[model samples]
Target: MLAFLVAGVILGVLARVLHHEPDDPSPVLTVVLGAVAAAAAGGVMNLFLGDDLTALTPWSFTSSCIVTFVLLGLLEGVWWRRP
Candidate 1:
């Protein structure tokens, strides 16, 4: 959980930095949302993949990251579409 939260925050910060748009969401908000999304994704992955929740395996980490990135991208797209 701790590792996932850290990873989420890092990814969120990286995403925010890379975008650097005036209309983008706040950094804190992005990090919080990213952490939540990552935790949710980790839970789902553990449920479906039969992996231990507390174990930080490579596969689990990779899947969580992939899910987080995809989710963030979708969120950005939705925000972009809003008028």
Candidate 2:
């Protein structure tokens, strides 16, 4: 859980930096959403793998990253479509 939160924060910051645009919402919101997505993904992965919340595995980490990025992309799309 701790590792996931840390990784999620890092990924969230990365997403904010890499995909940010002038019309987008607050950077802090983007990062928060990314972290939430990552943590949720990590928790789901751990549940499936029968591991503890803090368990750190390659697959779990990879899934967390992937889910976070995907959610960030979706968020960007939604923001883009807004008038």
Candidate 3:
């Protein structure tokens, strides 16, 4: 869980840095989304890997980062479409 959150935060910051715009959402939301994405991805990975809940693995971290970035992209798209 801790590792997931940590990775999430880092990925969130990365997303924020990469998605720079004149009118973007708050960093808090991005960070929160990253955290949630990481946790959800981690859970899915645990189910498939048959590992303990808190266990951290390279695959889990990679998946978490990927999911987080994907989610951030979705979020930016949604914001782009919003009036």
Best by TM-score: 2
Off by over 4 Å in 2: none
Tell how far residue 31 is off in model 3, in angstroms: 0.6
Q: What TM-score would you give candidate 1 relative to the actual structure?
A: 0.84
State candidate 2's TM-score. 0.87
Q: Once all C-alphas are superposed, what RMSD does model 2 give against the true structure?
A: 1.5
lDDT of 3 by residue, 1-83 (tens): 88898888888898889887867778998899989899889878977898887778888878877888888888876755458
| Local lDDT at 37 for model 2 | 84
Cα lDDT tens digits, model 2, 1-83, are 77777777888788778876788767888788878888889889988999987688888888998998888888877755577
For all predictions, the C-alpha RMSD in Å is: 1.6, 1.5, 1.6
The C-alpha stretches of model 3 lying farther than 4 A from their native spots are none
Looking at model 1, residue 19 earns an lDDT score of 74
Q: In candidate 3, which residue pairs get closer than 3 Å at backbone N, Cα or C atoms, i.e. clash?
A: none
TM-score of each predicted structure versus truth? 0.84, 0.87, 0.86
- Give candidate 1's whole-model lDDT: 0.75
